[model samples]
Target: MEISFVRIDDRLIHGQVATIWTKTSKCNRIMACSDEVAKDDLRKTLLLQVAPPEIKAYVLTIDKAIDAYKNPKYDSFKTLFLFTNPKDVVRMVKAGVPIKSVNVGGMCYKEGKIQITSAVSVSEEDIDAFKTLNEKGIELELRQVASENKVSLMSRLDSLKLI
Candidate 1:
């Protein structure tokens, strides 16, 4: 499977992802890898339902996603992988997935999490996971939309002295 794009988006699949990023990725498939979402039948169905016309979509657990990636049957698939957190991205990478870079997007603010941007927030765990990904040489870019300029996530954290 060719991972056309990998994005860490807490929303998983939404208007911006279904419309903009999918188009920008030029992928024929969109796979959301999250254990939480995969176990929720309603959310999985809803996410797949919102997929762009002519594009296939699936919500799978990280393990399943990794297995699918290693499967030769999906060799022709050009996929956009979406995750809700950086830890999951790190998990996939550690599982032998050749994820060269990751687009950090739409991590909503929650209590105990520092707001990094209007659309992004991070907790101590998130900061560590992001640092790990960066240490492993994965490009972490922050962009909420396709038309916006890409900002280095690590740099933003450094500038704020959060890391």
Candidate 2:
């Protein structure tokens, strides 16, 4: 239960994340929750190598990550839970990931997707998950970086108001 920061970024791991977030949050381990990446050991190795030696990188299936958090081994180390999309976030939420707040680090606005902020975008189904998490008292912050202003994802849910 030491994961303090959860971020949704489609790019997975990049230079800024391997450096900035690790330094900023003092996170020693990164648990990347993605079904696609979990099966790919080569990609996982690349991600692990990018971490600046002091940090540990773990690429896990969504289910494994949820299970891993419940293990007492994770209780000692502060981790950062990283996901590539809101769908994974929603799954983790439903599976009991024990996260309080989620920050929208990046979501590439695809065709027909509604962009709430430069950093936040939602498909119709994603909007529903956003509402679910919002109602459950999970704080959602729309920001591309730590310097960006915070915004509510609901405002972009096609005229949905303060539900």
Candidate 3:
């Protein structure tokens, strides 16, 4: 499956994720690759329930997400892989996950973060990590809804002199 987006949303999956991202991307699957959420059956079930029946959901650890996505089993469906935080995306990229860019959706406003002038807040670590990706030609965008403009985290990092 072609991954239309690699998003960093701490909520993992929810209403806007189901209706907005899925509809906008026209994806057939939603994969929540989170270590904590993957182990919690209840939360997994809850997240899965929010999605339409056609859009399959998988809650997985970073390793499992890398392994599963690399395999041929899910090659037929278009995917939108969701990571709970920027650290996970950094880890995935460090672990050789096949992601070119990361989209920041929602995460609490944290201290020392350049908010990137978007709905999400990013930390100094995120700025550094995103800068690493940007240097590697991976774009980091911030957006809550599909219609909104994608704010480049790279530029924000530059503004903070983090890049």
Candidate 4:
């Protein structure tokens, strides 16, 4: 499987992702890699249901995703990998997923989370996970839509003294 794009968007498989990113990356498959979501049948079903009919979608755990990615049957697939948080991205990379860069799309505001951008908010744990990914040379970019300019997430964190 060719991972055409990797994005950390809390709202997985949303409008921008379903249309813009999928088309921009030319992905045939959309893989929402989240252990928590995979176990929730309702969320998993909902996510799959929202995917554009022309594109296939899967809600998978990190390990299952790794297995699927390595499997020969999926060798021809161009997949857009989506995660809900930075730690999952870190886990996938540490487990040998060849993720060179990640788009921080929409990490929504929550109690105790610092707002990084208008659409993104991060907690201490999130910052640590992002720091780990940055240390491993993963480029983290912040962009809502394909038409907008991508900003460096790590740089923003650094400016805010979060990392």
Look at candidate 1 and tell me the lDDT of residue 25: 93
71-134: candidate 3 lDDT, tens digit per residue? 8877897889898787778777777766887888887777765565546777767666766777
Clashing pairs in 3: none
* Model 2 lDDT, residue 83, Cα: 91
TM-score of each: 0.98, 0.87, 0.88, 0.97
lDDT of model 2 at residue 135? 80
lDDT of 2 by residue, 1-163 (tens): 6876888888777787887877877887888889998888898888777877888788999999988888887787788888988778888888877789888788888987777666656677777777778888988777666665777665545454423
Point out where model 3 deviates above 4 Å: 110-118, 161-163
Question: Model 2 off-target regions past 4 Å?
Answer: 156-163
Clashing pairs in 1: none
Pick the winner on TM-score between candidates 1 and 2: 1
- Please give the lDDT score at residue 114 for candidate 4: 100
Which candidate's TM-score is highest?
A: 1
Of 2 and 3, the candidate ahead on lDDT is 3
lDDT digits (tens) for residues 1-163 of candidate 1: 9999999898898899989998899999999999999999999998989889889999999999999999999999999999999999999999999999899888998899999898999999999999999999999999989899999999999999997
Q: lDDT per residue, candidate 4, 16-84, as tens digits?
A: 899899999999999999999999999999899989999999999999998898899999999999999
TM-score, predicted candidate 2 vs. hidden true structure: 0.87
Higher-ranked by lDDT: 1 or 3: 1
